[model samples]
Target: MNDIVPLFGFTTTPLELVSFVLSVITVALNIRQTHWAWLFSILASGLYALVFAQSRLYGDAGLQLVFIAVSVWGWYQWLRGGTAHGELQISRLSGAGWAKSALMWLAGFGILSIFLKSYTDTDVPYMDGFLTAGSLLGQLLLSRKKLENWHVWILVDILYVSLYMYKHLMLTAILYALFVIMAAMGLRAWNNSAAVPAAVAGS
Candidate 1:
């Protein structure tokens, strides 16, 4: 694990470095609305599971496994699940969609937080559950091509950076900070794309 992997003047394990790079690549690809992002996400999540396990963050470790499954689903949806030509088109969530997503987030947080507190040795159950719930909804939105996914990620990633720092995972923390920036770029890109259609229809 102690192979030479440079991370901003600090050295880290190969697993951490690889996961960090994969996460960066995945989010960068996502910002471009590329289906290939899921492929990178699968690898990143697997490596991160191991990393979190080593850190004794069992909830986070489990979440990474869930991320692997979500990545596969996201890949299929992005490539073939759509109303036209089997390729998904980007779109915004309606008011009803927002309401449902909010409900899902709240329910997931409550359930996961309780489970973590009761079943795991995790020190920050609520915060971990918060990130997990937000990420689940964000992944669902991304798979469905909802433009709001980036917004969800922006909120989640900001908190995640601090969370990882608390756990002393500096390399991964930096990676999440980059995720924050990429998510912002993604939101802007999706907004511009969504606006183009509206402007054309208006004209």
Candidate 2:
């Protein structure tokens, strides 16, 4: 799986190619608010753990393991995390929620960067930790069907493209670039979904 092969005039490992395909499908399902996205996320994250490990991106490798666990919980959340244990619905974060999320991101970045720098040989510890933290927040918000999840994803995905490029993971970089676009579309779709309830209530 680690063997490099030519693909689309570029080079990538079979692991990465498979991960890229699964990840794209996962995001497409997510944009459509389908719970099946979490199932694909588990598959993608498992493969990506190996891909990032090979690149010595310990933060990302560790993050993929976390993603797998989170995907499972997220799957459950989407099924029964709403009012009265109903299916989760698209919603916006409150002002206090936004503030809390920001604090959590910063705190996670601090702890992760310190751990990665002290315990790993990764060359981009700070960058990796920052994105890893943001990704966790984004994933949490997404699990709950929060509108702000897309905002977090857009920023994190943009930065991930550059980080993957610097690490010479061209295929993964391209995947993150695509994530940015997909996240934006998700934002619009979720926003519209959230509004429908309000429109119906006012009718």
Candidate 3:
């Protein structure tokens, strides 16, 4: 749809460009370990919900709404989550932490995919659920300042790129491509940030 200039259906629409701009800022804030990232992500997702709905990507559209809720929780978590610190700091997830994350993602993916396949006319149920569940975990991890969140984002972003292409949303596809690269950069930034102690920084 991005390749064409139609009256609707991503043709002449500026949503993709808007989404890209918001996503870029979101990734940048994420790289700085700023809780503000979730704010931008939420706004981007709100726009994406409309785009996906127009494209009949029902599950993906619904997922964007979930992102809105997750962003709120993530924002609250980042602001005053740990004790009386008043700010959270980047950190690594422990072994059990990774395990719990894995289990939740797997279970959510399986159940959500099955439900979507049965309830909606979506073709790639697994892909939708996979991206959704991974994003949920990544967002939660990011909310807690866990560096491993980037890994989840990288994986989902790659898959999402292909999915957008499959839907003929070239702009969305390109945006996900950028997301993958930014996730990689965020990994480096967050990892380096983890090396410093939260008690010392002027966050």
**Which prediction has the highest lDDT against the true structure?**
2
Q: Is candidate 1 or candidate 3 better by TM-score?
A: 1
Measured over all alpha carbons after superposition, the RMSD of each candidate to the real structure, in angstroms, is 2.8, 2.0, 3.1
Model 3 superposed RMSD (Cα): 3.1
State each model's CA lDDT, in order.
Answer: 0.87, 0.94, 0.83
Worst 10 residues of 3 by lDDT: 1-10
TM-score of 1: 0.91
Worst window of 10 by summed lDDT in candidate 1: 193-202
Give per-model TM-scores: 0.91, 0.96, 0.89
lDDT of 3 by residue, 1-203 (tens): 24445533554357867877898898899888777888898999998888888876777788889889988988888888766856776778899998999999999899889988998888888888888888878877887878899999999999999898888887778778998999999998878777877666656
Instruction: Report, for all candidates in order, the number of backbone clashes.
Output: 0, 0, 0
Return the top candidate by TM-score: 2
Candidate 1, superposed: residue stretches over 4 Å from native? 2-11, 198-203
Candidate 1 residue lDDT tens string, 90-174 = 8988999999999999999999999999998888999988888998889889988899999899999999999988888888888
**Local error of candidate 1 at residue 177 (angstroms):** 1.0
